[model samples]
Target: MSTSDMQDANLQEALVTYEKLQDIEDDMDEVEVEILRQQDKLCKDIYAKRAEVITKIPQFWPLVIEQAPPDVDEYIQPSDSALLLNSLVNLTVERFELPQGDPRSVSIKWEFKENEYFENKVLEKKFWWRRARDGWAGLVSEPVDIKWKEGKDLTGGMLGLVQKVWEEEKAGKEGETEAAKKLKQLMEDTGLGGVSFFAWFGFRGRKISAEEDKEAFQKEQEHRQARKAGKETEEDAMDEDDDDSDDDEYEMEIFPTADDLAVCISEDLWPGAIKYFTNAQEQDDMSDIDFESDDEMDEDEPEGDAPANKKRKA
Candidate 1:
């Protein structure tokens, strides 16, 4: 055969190979669904066993949060730390949509004792795995209201104020108001409006029309398969610069870092609590060390306690 004939043959072979790869990817996605289902069942049983153990341990959740990596620790303001230490008793994360809905979704519940900070006995935040209009998918959640006591708001009222502004803007149909702008300024201010980690409960991410989002997702997937099969079409030629992944306009405001914080809690701190707790204890042990020999490491160590001077942040 001529050189041109060989080139055409090779191109056809490549297209066939690409089509095979797309089929394998689609099969993998199906397998992932079953894997998530199994994981959901396993986690439910594990969480039940953990619930009994964690409640007996004093300050278990707080210690885990305290020892979180610096990225997460930065969100825990001093007041937030104190509130968790005093009031937070039990924290649990579960695939709440079991038996029917998507198991990828999770609910994080915080069981708190009666405290001056908030009135509620329980605060739970549910995050759903949702796709936006542009087909990008992640965790999207509704805002959770935190009923603050008269003078004990850990968010410095920023979250509450943001919520109020969001409602007002939504009702008025006004584009953006002076109050929203001022609130943004206050949030930036150093003293008056420091946001707390607990404000993460009030996070509201993208949730436009569900049908449109799903349609876009389906369209994107079809286009992806076409591209993999070496087919060029209008969808492939569509403007790459077009972006629709921003949080829906219905959300007047957002906790900018909420997604990162949410993942940290659900994925890292919740799942790896035992590791974080052990690390916290090891940290406490290191502070009291007087290592005379290598064998001293395994010997009965002193009872590690929280720092005596760890006073409430005023």
Candidate 2:
């Protein structure tokens, strides 16, 4: 072929290859956008669901305590240690997006208040979470942060209790020991006896009777099963009086289903959860700045509205 004809054929082939590459890039961009949308939606859904669960604190808190890992019991203060779990007045949560990195991590803040102690004082806790490695998306807390009132001098007892638990944990891998139980009873006899101390550990303690809570939880499960079978529950048929006895102040379950709890805080279900998500807009801005810094520009190239760094030939 003539040199001019060969040059034209080469140009045509290059154009076709470039078009194919552009199509692949466009497809990738679309997929990335979809992923971002799904991530944002998941963040919002997790937040709303967590908030809903928080609202049921009064009813479901007991269930949460019951489900706690046994290790938690070791840290409980002798019920008389001025740590009043029943004094809890309310629970609140805050969720926020990170200013940078791995858009999926969310920071959550939990605030707990006590009506009877250190008037106007609040306990604040913070944790971070994101998707899981092996299961449905769920949050796992980092190290916990707790803030107590200043000048109250009340935290020492709780801190000491935690320290002792940690020491015991470090010294032995066995479950609750007779020595531990004796120490607890001695503390109680010496005026440390009290009710369940889960609240002091930042978990809302059981407010309802366990037996009643269990029965109610079971009823809810049965009700759901009946619905799935397209049948009305016996309680639904004889409803008015029995239902009337159930005050609005009651909650049957902390979580309606295992899946919701799992997605919110993993299968182990921490007392609370936090999750993270990257802010796409911030990420893009940072990328743009990085691209500009790394780009190789010629003196003749205008800086106005340029695309990202163009790859240079070796």
Candidate 3:
């Protein structure tokens, strides 16, 4: 070959080699870019997943807490008299939810304020579930006698006691007497009116006389029946007039329940209180997600993606 032709051939070969090398380098660059993009996406996804879990973990309890009314610190102050009063009030308020259903049965907790007392008595308080029209109702029992021992967690035990009280009240086992029923009904009505029975009576352990209570109940029933019967006959008219003359003869007695006492002392407390809590249903489209999955990201994703595919961590 001629020198000019040979030189041209060598240059052509070098250009072809350089072009091939450039193509390979471009492919590698593209692959590396793709890998880096995937890694960045994975890191973002992992971070989002972790954040979702943390957010959900605190959600359930906060929802429950939100439903409850704010605490009344001044009203809940400790005093020998106030403690006893609060005990009664708390018990009475607790009863309002009694005829309804169980809130305290699930998770019962109690907290007492420090340095508040009536006279020289230490306050005792508790919280428990009670029944309501909506579902389970929640109650924070006012301070009672603090006999809770050290190292002996009273949460579960107190729950049991509340359950027992609930059963007894439900079965009409504890206070089946006519007086008790009348007292219960009165307390329920009064509680709905924003009154607490505990604030009225300062001390606990006061027993109503069964005989007196029964007689008083009977008198109240007679009065109600009389009112229902409407006016009086001509012959009985004179007797009616006589009864009216002695209108002040029948003294009105106030019989309070433990629940009543609670409501009374609390004093218009629990305003706008929610009656109960209920469980909500999951959506049909979301059914594929395992209800028990610990990873919220896995649970929250749309159903269209590969059902078993674990998204790369961000």
Candidate 4:
């Protein structure tokens, strides 16, 4: 064969190998789903017990939120933290649809005591791990409504702006409409990327109906099966590009980063809440010790020499 013929053969060989690898990865993902289901079953009672104990501790959930990982803490501004510390009483994450619909679906319930922040006693955000169009599947959630008291809104009007954009989209406006531009401008003006972490409750990432998602998901599965069996039709080959192109459209979402934020909550914030609280305690203790040591050193040294020391440090 000529050199060109050999290159063509190599390209074809590479494509076949890539399809085989994708098939294996898809199978691994299925196993992962089962593992998640089993993990929930194993941890249900443990989480329930912990929930009972932690709720008794004053500000347990509040401190957990206050000392959350950077990815989460960045959302909890001082104002938002104040509301949470004052009102947030208990938080629980559960597979609300486990063994019924999707095991991966979680309801993160935030129980609030009576406070000036809002009227609702409990705020729950459910993240449904449903399949969407174009073989894409991840956590998608609807925004929860947080009824704030007059002049107590922490999200800086972001939730309302997002709702306006959604309303416009529902009313037939699409693709970076005027409302979306305003939403984007509000995010920039807030300088927090997402206004407040509390605004996360109002994030709506995907816009497809359940019926459409289900139909597309079925077609995606069929396409995957065809690829795995090396029975992909010419039509399937053409549709492959179209499927990938839809993914880029998600970036235009009003809350494009919300999906990543969701992962941080489910994986790091909820799963490791106790650990974060413990870490906060440890850091506080260390800070106290350091402060004491600094005081002792200050006393041992002359106060008049502080300026000299500062000059030397500079």
> At residue 115, what lDDT does model 3 achieve?
26
- Of the candidates shown, which would achieve the greatest lDDT relative to the real structure? 4
List pairs with backbone clashes in candidate 4. Answer: none
User: Residue-pair clashes per candidate, as listed?
Assistant: 0, 12, 46, 0
- Model 1 residue 72 distance off true place after TM-score fit, in angstroms: 2.5
Report the C-alpha lDDT of model 3 over 1-314, residue by residue, as the tens digit: 99999999999788656655655665685586465344434554563554465444333222222233333222222332243333322111222223232322111222233323223232333333232221212332322323334433222133223334334545767435454455445444554232222232212222223344446445544544444455321211235554453342111122123344344323333222222111111222243354445267667778887666553312
For candidate 1, write residues 1-314 as lDDT tens digits: 99999999999899778767866887797698677778767787787888788878979988888788776888878888888878888887877777776666788888899998889999988888776545466777767778999988776676776677657756875655676776667656633344677778767666555576568767867877676666764433433443432523323443666777777777678878899999988877765453333236435445684323322212
lDDT of 4 by residue, 1-314 (tens): 99999999999899888888888898998898788788888888888888888867887887788788888777666777888888788877787777756677777878888988788999888887766554557777776777878987777777766667667767887577776777678766666564666777776656556786679768877878788678853332346665565564453344567767777877788879899889878877877777677666777887676522321110
Cα lDDT, model 1, residue 64: 87
- lDDT per residue (tens digit) for residues 1-314 in model 2: 99999999999788656655655665685586466446555666675676686675552332343333434433345442234344433334333443333233333222335633345345443333322111112233312223444644243333334335435646875676554455445444544333233223321111233345446545655655554565533443444554443332112111112122222432223324221112323445676875665554544467785655654322
- Which lDDT value does model 3 have at 67? 31
TM-score of each: 0.72, 0.27, 0.23, 0.81
Q: Output the TM-score of candidate 2.
A: 0.27
Cα error, residue 49 of model 1, in Å, equals 0.9
| Per-residue error (Å), model 4, residue 192 | 6.0
Candidate 3 stretches with Cα past 4 Å from truth are: 1-72, 77-93, 96-144, 147-202, 205-207, 231-261, 264-314
Worst 10 residues of 2 by lDDT: 249-258
